[model samples]
Target: MAAVGYTSGDPRKVNDTGDTLTGGLVLSGGGSNLTVGGSGAVTGDLSVAGRLSAAGVALPTTFPGRRAPFRDPTRIVTHFQTGHGWATSGGVDAPTTNLNDTTDFAKGTQAAKVVFTGNGNLDISGLSSIDLTGKAIRFQVKVDDASKLSQLNIRVGTSTTNNFQWQTLASTATSKLYRSGEWTTVTVGWADVHGGAGTFSLDANRVPSATTGFTFIRFQVVATGGNCTVHFQSVEVIDNVSATFPNGVVSLVFDDSWDSQYALARPKMDQYSYRGTNYQIVERVGQAGRLTLPQLRTLQDQSGWEIAGHAYTTAIHDSRLTAFTARQVDDELRNLRAWLVANGFHGDSYAYPGGQFESTTDGASIEQIVSRYFSSGRTVLSGYGASTNVLSEQYPPPRPYRILALSGISDASGGQGLVSSLVAAGGELDTCKRLGSWLILTFHVLTTGSTGGDDGVITQANFNTLIDAINSYGIPVKTVADVMRYYT
Candidate 1:
């Protein structure tokens, strides 16, 4: 059956301004085939006919070509090759959406992108899906603007929970963009986003009450100042069934403090010789001590204490802005950097102090206050292997630092001993499915007190036991710095 509707001209209803027209039609139980030809006009504007839409055009079965279905141009991954060129500020060049341009990133580009204004969304209507798997939505973007960057945002919602406005899977989510201005590619795939009712619907009639599906892809300018321009060139959405992690990424983190511990590991420990009644150890605790030329030589000869910084506080986590003042943050960063330099260690990655990056979840922008100051950072968040949302301007996940956390030895409150307590307390091995990410873990002297003596410092036996347990659990133990290179 071929049902077509059309209109030519007539005394159509016009608005007061005469700039627009209105019309309506209702079709009930129609004939086997009805052809309402040349009769479609709205607001009296029938000067031209744009397209001919059929009521239904059933196909034989299969078709191909699954590039893009709908586009509003809000996200960089959805720019989809606009003929009009785009530009960026900060004297930086806009990133290319072409797959050939790879850089600061090693994971490879999944989408060609350009930034766009998030507040005013790119208007799209009467859109259709090409794949129809209704599994997930997939797309990528890149934003590396240093001078100016908005909170990369994306939101899609409906009028009511059940009474929807749009019938797409992308219905709700508030997102932000990074201001780094350096093209950061992004990918959004809803194939993993699950829902019920057998098939997904984006019509205003179907709304999800207790399910997961999107209605829209609303990209946003994350920072402030009202507007932004993003460039997006291509898009490819696949089902959740095919998602895979990036290639060859290990556990997150490679802290520099190990160097100091290693320094303390060799010659220093060799100096203490067992005499008649006691070991002749001669390094004062707490207070700095002047090393006599003879003692220094003897110690050096006995053990090799490599020239390294004390590594004062490699940061348990990134600066939690909600946890510190500007001065405090500056001081902490300065102290860490100066200590690293003084100790001959090239300051690269800083473990987030308190296992965090910003102070408060809603305080001064993380990128504005922190990322700009540091080269890279690592965090304790879990990983999906491929998409680790760590310390990123677009999607800053919980504990976003360097990599996705896979497991941990100690609990946050520092409780150790007893299998029941440890189990009840639960180690940090993630149970949920991550999208392929490098997991990072943190550790300190596991004791009930402080790090000064036989009281707080973890006993060598306990340390070995913990290491063995982590190994048994199949979680890898790594320092903080190593993971930063993978994501940031």
Candidate 2:
């Protein structure tokens, strides 16, 4: 008495959510069109293991979407692998990681620091809290069995003038974590910092003379030398919504700044090169912000990374996405996409800078048009995208969601894992759709000290742990562009 396959709906298609294939899963070859829609049903073992994808008549390199082929990259913005020895890959912004170097922090060779740079005043306007404690951005630093660290905490805001005049909403860094020396991970929770705590606050406020504000944050380490290595695993910033990996497959994309580098860590962004090229600091936004070539690499090397376009500030209004002009928005999208193609990127994902809440109220047609070009997108509704987000249900059109955190937003508070997401998703993994998936994470460096940055800029060590979690969950972490190709 084996279970029969679903007999309705087109499982492979991305319509307005409710339309779906109901039965008969298959593993046979060339069975894409074998969809048992609203009127068909399968009572046997349905298997479609070999089938030529949309690009061919025969099974191609792999089953369509089975392996989710990687997009060709135009460059490398930032990359690291604990298994690969934590060597720096593309572009350089902060201190570089060299697994080959005897100073490998993971191996306890030398000490490392997580630096954050930005335009002083952060915005942390709508979050619940900002405390970092057991919940800290973790990074794996391998010790050489002899490296010693006197300070396990952080030194933020030392790169700017405002220092640390921001408020502490809610944080866990009230104390610091000492490196145990065995793949030692340190946590600089929000409790460890305070308002006007400049010097090492990494809060980049506008200098007194600059119209914009201060412009940099450097996470430096107070270290005692030894000889080993530190393999950077991942950088996890929380509370962000983004279009990633498969959604907007591309050969090239541009990030527009080097501030994120400092946010990830001074060493984490060192000598960064992507697809085998180094990114240059293109420009600084006075106190407004800074743009870099490597930062641009995030757009270029999107084969693995996801890039989202944000409204040029001022896009969110009463939850009815509004801004300079539709033409302006269109221009931004076109420019961003063109840049990707120009650089050799093939991805087409879009992570709205503002969130799902920005769904245009009077411009439904305009939003729809944008949707046509991009595939399967989500505007944070009421679910945890990391685990609870899925492909089946229709999201609320008017945007019935709110973001407690975003990857790059500054947090004068505490956050970690899926706390906010879980709360938003209402703690239901069952609501997560397995097919028409959409994920988005947003970030803003200039807002951290005042407002709050998306918690996504996580510690390399914590990032790796998160990677393990995502992989363990069996949900493929895709670039937004790649996801769109299949959905569209």
Best by lDDT: 1
Residue 231 displacement (Å), model 1: 11
Taking the tens digit of each residue's C-alpha lDDT, what string does model 2 give over 56-173? 3222221112222222222221123333222121122245333334443433344332221211111112222232211212233433322333322222232434433211111112
Regions of candidate 1 where Cα sits further than 4 Å from its true position: 1-77, 80-335, 355-374, 379-435, 448-466, 469-478, 483-488
In order, candidate lDDTs are 0.30, 0.30
RMSD of 1: 28.7
Each candidate's TM vs. the true structure?
A: 0.34, 0.31
The runs of at least 3 residues in candidate 2 whose Cα sits more than 4 Å from the true structure, single-residue gaps closed, are 1-258, 261-291, 311-321, 356-364, 376-464, 472-474, 486-488
- How many times do residue backbones clash in model 1? 118
lDDT by residue (53-154, candidate 1, tens digit) is: 345422211111111122222223243443313222232223532323333332334323333333323322223423322223333444444224533433
Minimum summed lDDT over a 10-residue window in model 1 is located at 274-283
* Residue 337, candidate 2: C-alpha displacement in angstroms: 3.2
Taking all chains together, the TM-score of candidate 2 against the true structure is 0.31
Compared with the true structure, the alpha-carbon lDDT of candidate 1 equals 0.30
